[model samples]
Target: MRDMTGLEWFKSSYSGNDGPECVEVALTAEHIHIRDSKTADGDRLTVSADTWTSFLSHAVPRV
Candidate 1:
C-alpha cells in the first residue's frame, strides 16, 4: 500500500450527509484508491486506472 497521508480523498455527491456508508476515492497516476469514508484509517482497495474505468462502466447507470 502506498502512503495515503497526502492524498486528497473525495466522496460521491450522492452520498447522504448523515450516513456512515459513504465511500471515498483518491486518484494517483498509477492507481485509484477506494476506502470507507467512516474509516479513513482502515484498509483500502487500489486498482489501476484502466481497471477503475472498467468497473465504472459496469457500475454506473447510463442515461
Candidate 2:
C-alpha cells in the first residue's frame, strides 16, 4: 500500500449526528478508501473510483 497518511479523510454526510457507528472515506487518484470512524487504525476497504461511483449511483435513492 502506498503512503496514504497524507490523504484527507472525511465522514460520510449520510452518517448523521455523531453516532457510535460512522464511516470515513478518502480518495486517491484511482481509488476510494473506506474505514470505520470509531477505529481509525482498524480494518479498511479500498475500491476503484469507478466502482465507488457506480455503487453510489445504484445505492442512492432517486427523488
Candidate 3:
C-alpha cells in the first residue's frame, strides 16, 4: 500500500457497525481507492477513475 496520506475515506452506505463486511472508498482527481474498513493500514486497491466508472455502470446499471 502507498502512503494514502491526505486521502479522505468514506464507508459504504450499506455498511453498518455490526456488519461483518465493510468497505471504504476514497476518490481522487485521477483514481479511486478501495480499502477494508477493518484494516485501515492493510492492503488497498487503486483504480483509474474511468475504470471505476465502468465498474459502477456494470454493478449498478441505470433503470
Q: Give the per-residue Cα lDDT of candidate 1 at 28.
A: 89
Higher-TM-score candidate of 1 and 2: 1
Which sections of candidate 3 miss by over 4 Å? 1-4
Candidate 2 residues 1-63, lDDT tens each?
123488688876777765869888888899998988788788889999999999999999989
What local lDDT score does residue 16 receive in model 3, on the 0 to 100 scale? 79
lDDT of each: 0.88, 0.83, 0.86
Superposed on all Cα atoms, model 1 deviates from the true structure by an RMSD in Å of: 3.2
| lDDT accuracy of residue 4 in candidate 2 | 45
Question: Weakest 10 consecutive residues, lDDT, candidate 2?
Answer: 1-10
Top model by TM-score, which number?
1
Q: Is candidate 1 or candidate 3 better by lDDT?
A: 1
Candidate 1 accuracy as TM-score = 0.86
Task: List runs of model 1 lying over 4 Å from the truth.
Answer: 1-4
- Output the number of the lDDT-best candidate: 1
RMSD of 3: 3.3
lDDT of 1 by residue, 8-35 (tens): 8888889888999989999989999999
For each candidate in turn, the TM-score is 0.86, 0.79, 0.81
